[model samples]
Target: MSDQPPRDSHVYDGPVGGWGSAKGIAAVARTARPGPGAFDTLRRQNKPGGMMCSSCAWAKPPNPHIVEFCENGAKATLWDLTSARCGPDFFASHSVSELSGWSEYDLELAGRLTHPLRYDAETDRYVAVDWDTAFAAIGQELQALDPKMVAFYASGKAGLEASFLYALYARAYGHVNLPDSSNMCHETTSVALKTVIGTPVGTCVFEDFDHCDMILHVGQNPGTNSPRMLHPLQQAANRGCCIVAINPLREKGLLEFANPQSPWQMTLGAPTEIADRYLQVRAGGDIAALTGIAKQVLALDRTQGGVLDHAFLDAHAHGLQDWMDWVDACDWAELEQVSGLTRDAMEAIGAIYARAKAVIGVYGMGLTQHVHGSDAVGALVNLLLLRGNIGRKGAGISPVRGHSNVQGQRTVGITEKPELVPNDALRDLFGIAPPMDEGWNTTAFVQALLDGKAQGFVGLGGNLARAVPDTDRVAAAWGRMPLTVHVATRLNRTHLMPGRSSWILPCLVRAEVDMQDGVNQQVTVEDSFSHIHGSIGKRSPASPHLMSETAIVARLAAATLPASAKMPWDHWARDYARIRALIEVVYPDDFHDFEARMNQPGGFYRGNPARNRDWQTDSGKAQFTRPAALDATGLGVGPGLYRLITLRSNDQFNTTVYGLSDRLRGIEGDRMLIMMSPDDMAAEGLVAERRIALTGAADDGIGRRVAGLRVIPYDLPRGCIAGYFPELNPLSPLSRCDLASDTPATKGIPVRLDLT
Candidate 1:
């Protein structure tokens, strides 16, 4: 049966949750067929002190209810723990060239990888290899090459135990060339948060959601990407908390939702309306809108008595006047032109902010995946700072993280940069001098591989070849590496793009029990809100031969590094408690008594210094950042071109394609379609459902283009078009990036739709 969606281009008009979400969850289960005990996987998954959702990084509340998982969480678990198995026979049946033709959705659906497979270039097929032989070969390659010649690609899916080991192994091997998933998605959030707030993470915890009087959601569709968030939002709405949604599309999740988990709501069909005010901002116009709002608020403070928190501004913030001056200097016409909103509309938004005593600003990739993404994030923070919204209950900046453990992984050392974590502490802990040299991020790592400067590459979890921008270039670059190793559960496009010698090391998924030396091990993972919780998978492994990510890291370390002898690699690998013990020593104040807290009722919250009002910024106070003018970043759709932003289909997560349909937007049975404004479509004489090509207008050295995409009329800005990524990834300019964070400007692609 085809798991592809229906061929109707009808949008889902039902409430966000309720029966629609139930059907989605049930459909995912039937498609995944993750064995008979799949029900158990759903029950144990994200069950408070159980294994957290292996999906998005939206943190679980401190005291989670019995049924804590959402539809997305259920889908993720089902996908990971699917019953389908890909073993030696499956590899023998399909050649690398032939398998490359299969869709990403089909490849992952073929099931969990059951063995370590080495690519046989002669036959263009992968053959099984023993763990020892594969480990030794990889070790020999590492031993032969200089550490600088290698790049370590890490992501957030791995548990904290495994990620810590991966970082420890990389440092022990004498280099810090670790590029990770954060570089692609939330890196700008980190850079901006650190620069102004003195913390490189979201200041608000799940607790803040309970107390916030109002919520301003910008550039995020939580209905699809983070369905679990609907729980808190629905609760907040029920409690009379006002919400404003700012985005190009009118997302149904933000409009109304009926919690699937709530029996009364589900049965009665009584849905809670979410967004009190919906503001449709133009693509990449978030900063412009933010500036206008700030300007209006300043005006309101002048006219209305005591609107701005003067005491908070004077005592806890710096550069207030300069920021206010910049806001005042912004021209109303320019702001209106850029934001695509009238002055009155902007003031109304400002009025909401001015009225609220405590407000929370939540944003996602929509705010951070642009050329001026860092500036946009800083501007959002400035709005919060103006009213002392941050570092207090019910108010703060929350950049909704994408990956499950991306933030936590960074907390435990999955970074490409240097000196972020103190080197002396690492050296003293492991008796190994950590490499101090700045390393490559995702963008630099790709370039280095293309330049043939890197000899080997190791991916901890993510599908790097498909996930990165410039798909063709990345795939070609993958073939140039001398050795490439992937620690993964499912087969993907990246696994097929092998070098001279490539190893696909099969690893256990999050929903499977990881047995270490006869002990069922539970690993820790950090959530978006900086809460660290234990994750213990209860289901059996897809394959008996599968190795835990922790074991893989340990074996790789033991084979490659002599310092592995000094470190308790064997003990730590056998029992994850040892890993926690080591982590506690490294981050004493945060992870104190780490092992003891694993089984607690609710996971420990690693307090954010910024949230506690302790500003450790360079200025010793919260810095009021002045966002640049609308045209400051030099961003544009080009002459006769449109701004193309990549979006995630309701069925997909990152690069993983759950299905071929996006029910939210009504497109079905296809992923290769672009949503355009009707006016833009008419201007270009392009009819709806007509197939066309999109050419990149970026001046980057490399040529970028994608062909055979259907255009559909949608409610969006005139100069903006929307397409799905990994498909549209080729159109993303490799050179055009957020300058401050080195993140690819994925959400701001300059493109021209071609009909001829």
Candidate 2:
């Protein structure tokens, strides 16, 4: 055998100057290999004249700072500005087959695409194509298909104007298949909230944290997912606001968040205490825990003769009788078995809820990505209703969203189930009827691919392949498509998933100038706080060849739509203000002064139905609903099988891996490990550090098994196990989603484990 050079030291020492030594050190060490730009990325973050928070949409630059940002924000900034660049020559040298073998990180690190490229299957390589030919080909393919056959996907990273035009084009062409990021993250919230509140958005404002006495966070990690949220969380905890975290994993940031803003904090390493009570529930057991709390609260109300806001429930809620009967009928034994919390723990949580003057219930994907996700969320809302938490100051339901403008994108008409087409508004604005019928969601879109019924896919700025579940299955499904058009900022794994003819259209990054009609136009982003702020990129584009997302979208729209549509497609390309004007018409009441609000310092909240107790349910009152419990008999006759919940890391986002480190979990470099209780591991005859294989229980005909999963014993509840998503997505069949929402139960997969 040929002699191989000695491998680099597997051991990871602390970084220079003692920074990122422990968790960060271990985090970076866990990655297969470090990105070349990791070290210099942060240095360039605050360089003498680099992009600053002042230019970011999440930040209010003119206002005095008070813990203005989070670690994830810093990571996003650094990752985007990294010195990695994969130019035209890189693609010229490597064939699609060769590049397909590389990992997500390696492909991303190769850098930005300098020009538009098309894959030529005969030559087995991608060749550079100019904007004109690329647009023409995409238009030709789109025109050939019945618009309904082509699906349009929108990512949260897409801008409002781009998304608006995208929605118009899809509807104008009569195809309603607009599956978006919301499908994966908060679609359940929409399904549940809309049924209760008549609107899909949240009821609380970001400022409510300052006024609330208690904040109940379930399954949301502000530390990693929304770093900007940490400031409010810390501020609330500091001001005697009771913070309760209910999650399977004891996240590091939820316990203590290090504020990078405070001078004292920065110098002395001050970390703020977050959760006053940490409830470690088992995976997929949130519904039971939440329902148990509700039962206790209801019982206490009866005992005390004043626990629930009976008057509020009477006036503002419907279906109370049904809700009460369901809660009363739940067996304590079943609840306890499913929730894995003691009676005392349940009472303790109930007392907290009953005593708090005002409380806010905030959740993330944990409450949404389950088999009964919508009903689970309804249970949470039912608990809030017992206390009259909704429609009150400092207390309401807040779904902390991922991606900057995901909520905004949904608000701007990107939906598979859009409400009736307001023909009057369409005629007054576009002078035509937009598609009124329902369309495909993410799950439905993927199903279409599997059936080989869909011919084309137009992704408007997202890594769809990695974000969706069962990547290998979807990869094979995508191969049947005749055309795939991707408009993106940089090259991602999605770009390499080629069809017969693939077009990669390069677009400007959100943090770069978007010039139109010989002038730099500013775009706006809505934050988790329901505040819309102006964003103008301070840095130059990664390359001069890229076009603004708006322009690319407009070009495609113009090419695909017919002349008889009576819409001014060409005008939208030269300016986005017109698009905002159209938005005002569509959402006239909410976005009354879109332009003026866009220019304001502190962005304004569009609507707060709860502020005035404006319950818009069918009965003019908030309705309570729940799904029947999972049949214990259905849970295979075995002790070793359990539900598996997949989660994101502190250093990562949804399907977008910045690095392999998870700072909160005390995990360094691995994403394939399972977090299980020591007793559970011992009972199964599994070692703590040994590798295991996780096989899924049957769901449809698609069964999956992930091997070589490192088992890490933690303080998790028995019958509960946790693993990272995308890596563990193979173990979750696409059919295993919530019935009401079609959200893949990534949080609840029945699985069996064995030593590898």
Candidate 3:
């Protein structure tokens, strides 16, 4: 393998979703070699009673598209359904030390894990172990430690059943230390929105796209993160709905899209212009931009009386005047400087919002992965509340989540906060007094591991080691743990970082059949829109040694818990309906008739009370929160420093690297490169392809740096830079995070670039 990163970089001026998307699918298919059956499986994605796309949390449309899967979705599905298998023989050939040197893409491409493997310290290799022995060993390790010292981490890929069982097992064993993928990404949305709108979830459904007059596309690249969303954006554009994109980068998806399914559009190469206007705001300037927009809206309301929704505000909201007063006090010069946008541009967007009868605010991790992520979300909510966007048709705040079923994991009680869990119901149902202590979030969990406070870790799914900030420090702490167990479909970087006693238990992927007690089972997932639906696997399992996640959790709980425990783990493992029944008992309002709803054509919508103006806050009304200042992220980027925004490539999903090509950005075979503006390159005396090192500019004494990164001149802000995630995650310190959400400030890290 070559040590040099790919230096081929050019401008991609094409549309986002035409032949480019089709070719992307073809490329993955070539690498995956998923066979002819994979095509049939693709057709079934997002269809009622069929398999769900495992890529993103975008809601399934009520009237579904024939081919619902998008490029990334196809990649995720084909990647899972690939024929390559990583058995004991493959492990025998490559030692862990040798495998650690491989790229993330190469590691996963090696194929799906086919058996349970236990780390052998003597041989320095993972040796195959029986399921019974693996479970017993893991259970014994857990039994030796205090429940508070054990962390149960879950990935969004797992189904609601598995997540519920995982949470139950953790709580029944006497701990609430349930840190999940949400902690790393959307925790800001949950924490901020709950305080603003009395609900942690978005208010709009799939049908909202049709009725909305405008969509404020804030800080999200839909083409790569969630391609299924393109259909709605395209439809919205064709129907003359105003779409304004607010982000640091001019994402191709937000600019234009061609429906691959539409033959005329594809043939003519006439892509739908998605965004009517695009604002390239500076990194960490989301709160300032939103505040400026809100200020403009308030100005319009003062000049034109009908601009503000006084009726809605008077009836269903609180703190409007206080927030409006704060906005009025903010000076235009400060707002412009902080937001990196002219007052005229903000006014133009505000004018659009004022004219639209109903507008939807759509954002992603860009707004939620900052030091003021929670405040940024709160600011967006304040703007929406000014026009009565919530509790109405065609209007609301929508945070586009990344992973499939991630929202469902939180819905099924996989959270560190004890208040989020239904402890009363759990105690009554399982006859166990659940711990109410506030447990560790992702940041705190890593700290505990480093401090030697945590002894064991159980990962339901996900690459947590690479997903979090301070990777080098976290990996070292992970190695020192007494025990760690990961239940996954494939081998990842997290699996390579073995603890003192580590075990990798292979589990069936979403594409594979999950059979329990000779009966085929279907697992349910909750989408970003809060729609609960069932997903049944259409393909065969990669290996006979694999078990379903639900079965693994149940069996592990049975093995770990005392004999006096009242839970019927064996029964729940055999039949998932029993697990759903317990879930219904815990969350009676949402999961009522869970099995019956799963059997429905499109399942049922888990209703949001805030949609109907029923506020669950202390004041019984939606509240307008005032940001303390124009700049929410308090990082000061001096002459030599830049505000670094971490990004995902077109060929990647979350931490899963599918390939080296980022077709949308016109970059092929590279992940270790930074994007900078031509002017900034010249000003800093740097050239394209120049190797540089980025050191975190945080005042903390911890020296965090990433070297051997090539610089690529692109269309970026003067003091702003961009790079791929996880590779740059090392520059974000574990301590520098959103105080309210504990989500690492991955989007806006202050870093100084030095020529290598």
Candidate 4:
């Protein structure tokens, strides 16, 4: 038995909503001066068949209310339409060296990018350059380099239209090096879900929350990462749904949520109590916990005939008896040892699952950002498959995504590994030969850059330098590149870490009203549940010079490719509907009747055959897998060593830091802090507020270490510690990654911590 950590000084004890959410929305709304009211902007966001909120991928309402966005959604919306402006004059005064020293928070606060800038070697400054000249310069470098040397990356910031064009452009250049942020976040979900369900996306829709009797949330803090999700979670709880939370930290939002949207919650009624049973498990131990639950469920099914849907299993699934036998053979002692969860607790949750007619298992990267990330996903699916939860009214497995359109980008061809090469239809449509060879993913691209095999790079969105593991290492490789281009809405750390020749091309954000050729245009984005809808900006552009992502890709494509390699690049850029029409041709089954659906109430679903129990897998039925997590133990991590997992603050979204204060966790004025269990802290001779250093446990030839991290003791699993990412990303070596997805196993970092 180990002693729990002391109460954190900064741990927020306040209820989720009440005045907190109201103040947050008001504060964010005020930042966007010279813009419309926050309520007005929110109204436009929910307008019938209008632009989707840029903040998160949570499902929006079909027939929405006047204020359709959550507090975080409001923050993301207003931040993009901020009154503060950053133009060429500001850059003229600030040298690249000076800007390099600024923090990510301060850099974004400097405001939206105003002009296209190119690095001037003589002055070490980014001076504004005309779009054509910048395009031509980059084109010449790409022409000089081998096709394999060019690495084109996309991000959630780029909508479906831009993503499709970027993927098309890269392949037209004779390669498929189109690695995006999906490779870093939910790539494991994409791979694992497809393996079992024959589709890469979730089988359930937002409506599932309403009908579900129980929700088994594992390894996710929806309060911070996906705050919007808290709305439905609270609503579900209010409706008497039993919610069970399995996480390292008992987050405030999961404990007590105050929905500002609900009048009863805002005024006098008690705040919606979220978790009926909150189980704290060791980080990366979710798979073991899940396995234990499945063991209990299997036992209940064998003795209690109706517990498992035997009919559904016999009709639609295979390999169940083998999986059940494997579960029965598991040792309870090892399950508790690995998961840090008691057998009694596991059985209690299993009993809940057995009794409930409908159950939904919702999870996040806490399970997928580990060494056995893919296996963890499969394990969750296995739990769902046991009771025939898929294709049901209120039952499914959801790997909740963080970004706005990371999934949508993948749907629209922002992938290096394309299953379909240019068939006769593709070749005839584009008049270009699609590359046959598979391309590099994020991990492959990183290794390629370090090995000096990759030369040219084009980033559609995202801060690649800071976002990737080993920030300094990635930045070094990026600087050595012959040419690099960033098409973005605002300034970021990656923009400052430039190549020998780099261009910063400003683009319109989701908040900005985009009018091409005097005609108003709208772009489409797919939510986490695979619902595609139109997004049209209500506010004016942050800068008049800023172009749309579609326009930027179109120009870049026109400049790089020879005229013989033909496509309707210019025409599609002028009218995005043309691009949608092309999407219809490319993916007819999904994007068919794209325009009419975009105009309809809410949006139409991108049909998933697996949702109807139509297994597209090679086996003819859903396959259950036994995860490798059973072997996961901090084996050699004894005295001074620990397994560290990186986290994001409630104040930030992905790599975009809105503020330094993490209001949800009650931390302020710093980001270099680590949360540890009391027993682990005492063992390391660490005291409260003491600064510490973290060194990579494994000697992978990359001596990764980070200093100046402050200690904060909290109730956490023993031998496990947590720290904020992008800051702690340096300590997490690139070698620590899942072999299945190449996603850096940031959550499964083995490290040795000591006083700084």
Task: Name the best candidate (by lDDT).
Answer: 3
Clashes of each: 0, 4, 0, 2
Off by over 4 Å in 1: 1-10, 631-633
lDDT scores in order? 0.85, 0.73, 0.88, 0.81
Runs in model 3 lying further than 4 Å from the true structure: 1-10
Please tell me which model should have the higher lDDT, number 1 or number 3.
3
Candidate achieving the largest TM-score: 3
Per-residue CA lDDT of candidate 2, range 1-756, in tens? 111112320112221112342334344333324244433333333222222332122333334354243455555654565555667788878988888887666776676667888988886777888888998888888888877778999988776788888888888878789998888878888888888777677888766677899888998776667666677788898899888888876666577765655656655755677888888776666788888888899888889878889899888888888878988898888777777677677778898889988899999887888877887788788888887898888899888887778877777788887573355676577765767778999999988888888889999888887778777788878867988999876677777778888989888775566778877876766755566665566556777888888889888888887765457777867888888888888878767899888756556677767567887778888888766653211233356678787888766767767676764555766678888877777788876678888988755666678898888776666787888877787777778677777877788778888664
lDDT of 4 at 225: 75
TM-scores of all predicted structures = 0.97, 0.91, 0.98, 0.97
Query: Across residues 71-138, which tens digit of lDDT does each residue of candidate 3 receive?
Result: 99999999998888989998898888888888889899989899999999877789999999998988
- What's the best-to-worst order under lDDT? 3, 1, 4, 2
Model 1 TM-score (2 dp): 0.97
Model 2 residue runs over 4 Å out of place are 1-67, 267-270, 420-423, 630-637
Worst lDDT run of 10 residues, candidate 4, spans 1-10
* Candidate 4 Cα RMSD (Å): 2.1
Tens-digit per-residue lDDT, 538-602, candidate 4: 67787788899999999888888887535868888999988898888888888888988975655
Q: Which candidate, 3 or 4, has the higher TM-score?
A: 3
